[model samples]
Target chain A: MKSFLSLLIAFVAINTELFAAEAGMPQLDPTYWASQAFWLILVFTILYISISKFYLPKIKDNLDNRENKIKEDLENANKFKEESEAKLKEYDLILENAKKEVLKIHFESKSTLDKDIQSKKESMEKEIEKEILKAQKEISELKKNSISSIQIISGSIVSNIIENISGDKLNESSIKATVEDVSKKNMNKFL
Target chain B: MQQFTVQRIGPEINIVGVDLSFTNASLFMVISAAVIMLFLFLGSKEKKVIPNKLQLIAEMSYTFVAKMISDTAGSKARPYFPFIFSLFMFVLFCNMVGMLPYSFTVTSHIIVTLIMALFIFIAVTIIGFIKHGFKYLSIFVPSGVPAVLLPLITIIEIISYLSRPVSLSVRLFANMMAGHTMLKVFGGFVVSLGILGGWLPLSFSVALTGLEILVAFLQAYVFAILTCIYLNDALNLHH
Candidate 1:
């Protein structure tokens, strides 16, 4: 602040005298000022052109390049996201197929176990049916053989008893009764 | 009150090793430039999404230039946006700086404004020639005119087109010089009068100051917009 004040004071002290000298010196014609203005403008135009060509265009190009880079990055990001989503979809389908294969294997295993159990049950039933038929045939055959023996023994015993009881008459019936009586007494020797 | 006077303050290039120098007006011009730079830099420091007081001023200036470029130059002129923006801001700052209590307006000088206007004139002319080659000369030729009137109409068109720089610079410099001189003269009157007599001139000065502010903004707008129009002539030279 002090330096600025001093500079201002110095400029004031210097310019005041210069202005006095220039003033009251009969003004330069107005047309001269206009001509000076014309030349000054020419100089300014040259400066602006130099600056515009050298400095401004580079600044503008830098700005444009930055904008273009941002746009390109955004586009690339979108494409990458799309590609990743496609890969994700493919992975999901593969995962789903693998699950289905596991389920199919489990179902086939269970059905095979069930088939084995059903076959074992059917063979066991057939064997039991065959054993039951054989046992029935043996029992019937033994009963027939025992019935004939018992009938013959009973006939002889009845004849011997008739003969002992009724001494007098017999005839054909009497012969049977005498035989039965003889079988009962000597029973063994009876004819 | 004491009389104002000028005296030697410093040395420069001289006939006998004495220093050459500047004047009171030149000194004030340097001060004006400094003040303008300070105000603009400070005003922009608090740039916010929603502006504070200083930022509002800065934003208003930005909007002013943007609107001018869009209106006069059209969308094609958008590529030159920053240059036009800087020009408007610089001129506007210089004008407002002059409105301070004891400040001198550098823009009141023909040298300053003529420098500006001349640059625009040359730049636009060069751009026209470059863009359209020799065909740009047809801008001076009147269209659909009778063959007998061709020479007369062509002279009128040439004079009108040639007067652009004069009109552009003079409007700004003359207005600034006239307004300040009037203000100074009226200020002398108010000081010379006492008590009740001073009131009328004081009030008038106040209204004039307000009007001067509006003129200041308008002058800056006119300058920038005219530049845009010239730019359009270069890019698209319409009859």
Candidate 2:
């Protein structure tokens, strides 16, 4: 409160004197020019030193740092892009190799299965042919046997019929010889 | 007019017969300088990658002055950036501070502006002489001019060159002083005219105050830009 009071007093005192002055042209007052100029010089020098030494450099550093950071970020982005591109290429190559490998395995398995099937089919056909040939031979043999039996039966019947009808019996030796001769002739015809 | 008067704040001291009294003008000058210093110091403290408002203002002012110097004086004037920057800030602050009610305008005084202008003029002249030697005088002799009119042209050129500091200082001091005086005069009218009649002058005073603000900024810019131009002429020796 005392300080504020003194300040008010000082202000009044200063204004009182300021009012007493004629107020014609303050700029033309030669008495104050020297002091104003001196103060100006002193204050300006101090300001210049402070600005040049400290303030300006800090602002400059901020700008330079931003520039460098941007440059670094750009470089990093470029590097990441290249790396991803390389990875994509590698992935494509691996995928292509896998596809080729799969195709090769498929073809190899197919060929092996075909060969196995073909061999199995060929063996089955050979077995069927052998069985057919054996059955054919048996049929031919049965036909030959049946034909002989039929001839023998027919000769016996003829002999009986001749013996009954004539009432006098022929000689057994002759009959037998005749039958043998006839049967021989008949076998030669059939054969 | 009373506002323009310089009041001594304390006891007057005589140094080698020179009266160096701490006056209102000195106080205001010191205040302006301190304000500039504090503003810059606080504004630049953070140094963030992404700047806040204060930092942005600080940075803007820095670039503003930098661009002004480069535009007017080119790269050769880079070495004198501190002086030019100081002058601009000081003048700009003084002008701005004067806008506050009952505050002193340091730039209103011819001596202050004269000192600054004279210093710039002398410094630039010294630089020109040192760099170009006696050939610096050839600036007065235009190449296309006939020899018959050479003397007249030379004299005119010398006069014009000598008038640079006078015009530079007077331009700032007069503008500031005149604007403040007009404001004071209008303010007086407003007080004397009473409530009903005061409104018109009050409105005019408002308008004039806005104009004065613009003039304040422009005068500072003109002062700094003119300094840069003069510096350019000296440094580059432009024909």
- What is each predicted model's overall lDDT from 0 to 1? 0.65, 0.86
lDDT, candidate 1, A1-191, per-residue tens: 58655654554455455445556421222523433343334433443453345433443344355567778989999999999999999999999999999999999999999999999989998888888888878777765554444445555555556667975434555555555565457633522
- Reference-based lDDT, residue A132, model 2: 95
Clash pairs for candidate 2 = none
TM-score of chain B of each: 0.83, 0.97
Task: List candidate 2 segments past 4 Å from native.
Answer: A1-23, A113-191
Model 2 chain B poorest ten-residue lDDT run: B188-197
What are the RMSDs of all candidates, in order? 12.9, 9.5
Write one digit per residue (lDDT tens) for candidate 2, span B65-96.
89999998999999999888888888999999
